[model samples]
Target chain A: MKIRHRDSDSGKIQLEMTPMIDIVFQLLVFFIMTFKVVAVEGDFNIKMPRMSAGGAPSDQLIPPLRVRLTTPQDPNAPVCGIYFGQRQLASFEDLRNEVAATVGGGGPNADADEYEVELDCDFDLPYRFVIDAITAVSGYRDPSSGQIVPLVRKIKFAPPRQASGG
Target chain B: MRYKKADNELLEADLTPMIDMTFQLIAFFMLIINFTEAEQDQRIQLPKSELARPPEQPFEVALTIQLMKDSKTDQELIIYGGEVMPLANLQRVLAREREYLTRTKRSPADATIIIRADGRAKTGVVQQIIETCQEVGFEQFALRAQQEEAG
Candidate 1:
């Protein structure tokens, strides 16, 4: 009897995996490049004052007015701030006048458009200061438009940290 | 005349390289992933305001106070930031930190008192922390809370 080897069984299996490997490594590199391990410090747990009443109805994006409260030049003290817009306003009255002028110039339906004035205050600042700031912003109205935008309504308060407490 | 026939035609896929690359990619994501808690494990949510902007300069180290219910006993107050210090001492420590920052001319503004109060933690305790932060020279603060859920 003669011993015979099977030629088909003897051949090595060759799989074309170069492209697959390339993709795998590419994905690896991509993830490595984009991966960020942020050491987020601080405990994020508190009941933030409810901001949205029903969520600003789907249609409204208006210019925002800003009111920032700074630590009185003295760090050991309470907070105070300067209220001014691009147009220099000497007093609270001037701020109101500028707002009225701006709104009046905007023409029809400008009043219907939402006007948001945001108050920026430190967490440490007495809530009273924030309330007071809200009051000031509320007093400004465009008599021509008969629009009375609330002072602090539709407000967004952010944490001083890069990320919000949430 | 007659012709001879071929014995075999074989094809196989090599998976060695592909498997190696997949392992490497998985490793990369494993190393660089940042895991922020999706929900407040402690059930607290933070407020958002537009006025909140990043500090001009990175803040220097200061005492931080974390208020959590004791994980073990559930009765004691667990205050851990740098060390476990009593809330009463918080004001004194902050005032001292303020003077030191001022003496160093580093701007007391750079030091912040991070208050991490559990959602259930009484508002009174949070108020106390606020009072201390105000009494001390520290003006900068970051209130931490879970983000609200998307509706």
Candidate 2:
């Protein structure tokens, strides 16, 4: 004997929403789990000249400005001393001011082309200190526009110095 | 007792609202996701700098090197192409990269080397890496740093 339903509604079609919702939720969860918010990263472009065994000595007119970074013997000390040539700088601000002065007062026609800053850092000095010194000597803020103008485009790294006994 | 049946009614839940919410979530995730995360190593904490500026133009060919300190040995380890290696191995890798670039008719000067060193890492280690890169004929260098807010 054949059995038939009395209330058969086979002609109407319905889309299954459960599975679709399940997949969508899964995708949302995946994306949310993988999402990472990171701080903006940038780069300071530099040109590293090829190292040569020997080169002829030339008569150079201007000497590169040297910035020496000395770290305390105590590893726990967070402060590092910044020096501009023979003069010790009180802070990064002082170093920046001294750099600006040496670069002819940050004028429009200031001869930044002839300026080069040599960063001589101790072997134990943290990388943060080197970048801080670079920031101090590399550029200056424009008082009028509040924009950072490049002062010394060229930067050279001197041989790392051994940390002296404090 | 006999019961009389009422009219049959089909119940449905609207899926439009659910789909709209999912799409909104997808958009938010897409905006925050970083495709360049592979180039960045979470083990390395980048130094913060106010002078760090975004590149004027993206380099067509760039190599990223991540430097981090080994917690166990307290020695600097260089991570290149997701492989952690010592300085000698890194130098060899750079040499190979330079050779590959030369074979592909690309100038070593055109290829940019981006160094991402930890903030607390010694400056001398980074300097040595630069010196190694220079020895391998890489002229263009980019020091990666996080952009710090100016006071």
What does the lDDT read for residue B21 in candidate 1?
Answer: 62
Please give the lDDT score at residue B149 for candidate 1: 25
Q: Pairing residues by index, what is the TM-score of model 1?
A: 0.37
Per-model fnat list:
0.15, 0.82
- TM-scores across all candidates? 0.37, 0.86
Off by over 4 Å in 2: A1-13, A52-61, A74-78, A142-144, A162-166, B1-10
Error of 1 at A81 (Å): 31
lDDT of 1 at B130: 57
> Tens-digit lDDT track for model 1 on B38-150?
32223232332222223455546645566654546542253543455567777776667778777887865556666655533433445556556655545555555332222
How many residue pairs clash in all the candidates, one count each?
13, 0
The residue-by-residue lDDT of candidate 2 on A1-166, one tens digit each, is 9987666665666687789888888888988888777888888777656642112222334787889888766654655888899999888889989999998866788877688777888887888777777777778667678798878877778865654433
Candidate 2: give the clashing pairs: none
